[model samples]
Target chain A: MQLQAEEYELQFSILVKRLGSWLSGQTGVAKAYVTLRDSQLLFLVVTKSTKYDSDFEDALSDLDIELANDPDLRDITLSVLSIPNVPSDSLSSFMHPTTNFEIQRGGNDG
Target chain B: MAETTVKDRLRLVERNHDALVALIEDARNPHDEWVATIAFYKAIQLVEALLAKRHGSVSTSHFRRLERLRVHHKDIYKQFRPLYNASMVARYLCLPDEPGSTSVAYFSSFSDYIGDAKAAIINGRLIQLEALVEKGLGEPFTKTRV
Candidate 1:
């Protein structure tokens, strides 16, 4: 059950996607994007509204425990951030393929 | 606003690096958690600036930014992962019931607590990242543009 670094990353990515989809099905959640950096788990959960209801907190608590039990993700810090749901158009734009652009002022343009 | 060029991102990298140095010094004086908080952000901003130079765009989402680095520049990603983890812990993971007040006792036992040596290491990584970005930018723009 020893996983290499790449293996861990791949497994975690799949796990995050599945978890996100499931979380989105819940009452308050609209969409979810999960990331594990250095094995620390962070869920960027898009919510139907800004306020976090009790049901949402309960679900997040359960999700946290579930992620902790996974062999590959155990012992890592787990947290969630709730953000307003994004428009479909904007999400689609974000998914578009990246294009090369001329570097403009303040290479920090991003 | 016009698009940011590699030159602009390079300048940002330098600015964040300078800020990080100052924060490290400030942290030594009062051991304030806010110092670590600002330092963490500076570290992230510095790395993002370097990534913008390479990819021609940088992600706004922290995770996405790291993912891009992992995909395109594994070497840089490896160096950055720990810094990101430390910063996350400093900012989001460990906290007191009160706002703006950090419990030193709580922080001492926090799993991802960033010690002085770790802070130094993060600074060192920023230096390396800056050098790498500058070298990459030195190449012909047409060849590096992607």
Candidate 2:
């Protein structure tokens, strides 16, 4: 069966919501939101507690659910196979998002 | 800290386009190392995030590469589908919680942004590679001519 990019994206989106919520519930992430960018999908599982990142991933693994990249399932699996740049502490998490407010990368839109 | 100029970024994009394509190929291939595969997706996400930050969105050719990859390798990339859309995932790590704070709140937040930026760049490169592969060299390119 051939699936279009958006089709894959839709399935992936549903999965993230189901899996992210499940993971959040298990890990105590009160408000977990899932977002899909093009075909790439991401689960922004938020919580009042900072340590929930690790727990969320762990819970996802525990459930044996993995994030998918539209058609690149293996790559998607690989993306999740490792520990993302999750913050271990507040201090480290503080420096997580770089201040690229006005600064742009590549410097070109075209 | 790219350690290079705009010209260098372009060169790097051109020189390494093939590698990025291959990375996605390997990532989509299940026979490859599981750990490496995940890293490839992570890396792509990082570059895409970066490119998106700079350009508001990835280019036409870049988006095409995404289409081709998705068409050929659905299962492999399925695990990272959310990161592709990545609306909320990035926010988990980045984004300012407080309204008025100029600086990001946490170190990890910065890390996520930088890492994601890298992913955006790499992901964007996938399309550039496709252009190079489909079209002959020395052709008129969108970002730069080959």
User: Candidate 1's residue-wise lDDT over B18-130, tens digit each?
Assistant: 65456556634544344445445554655555566656677867656755665566555544544443344444442223434432222222222334433334443434444
Cα lDDT tens digits for candidate 1, A1-110: 76478876666555555464555457666555544433445555555653223345445545544554566654244454443344433232222223211111222123
C-alpha displacement of B108 in model 1, angstroms? 3.4
After superposition, which runs of candidate 2 have C-alpha atoms over 4 Å from their true positions?
Answer: A4-17, A20-24, A61-110, B1-146
- The 10-residue segment of model 2 chain B with minimum total lDDT is B137-146
Enumerate the candidates' DockQ scores in order.
Answer: 0.03, 0.06
Report lDDT (Cα) of residue B3, candidate 1. 37
lDDT of 2 by residue, B34-100 (tens): 2223334443443433334343444255444344334443432233333333323333334234334
DockQ-based class of model 2: incorrect
- Candidate 2 docks with a DockQ of 0.06
What i-RMS does each candidate reach, in Å?
Answer: 14.6, 9.7
Total backbone collisions for each predicted model: 7, 76
| Predictions in order: chain A TM-score | 0.54, 0.37
- Each model's lDDT comes to 0.46, 0.35
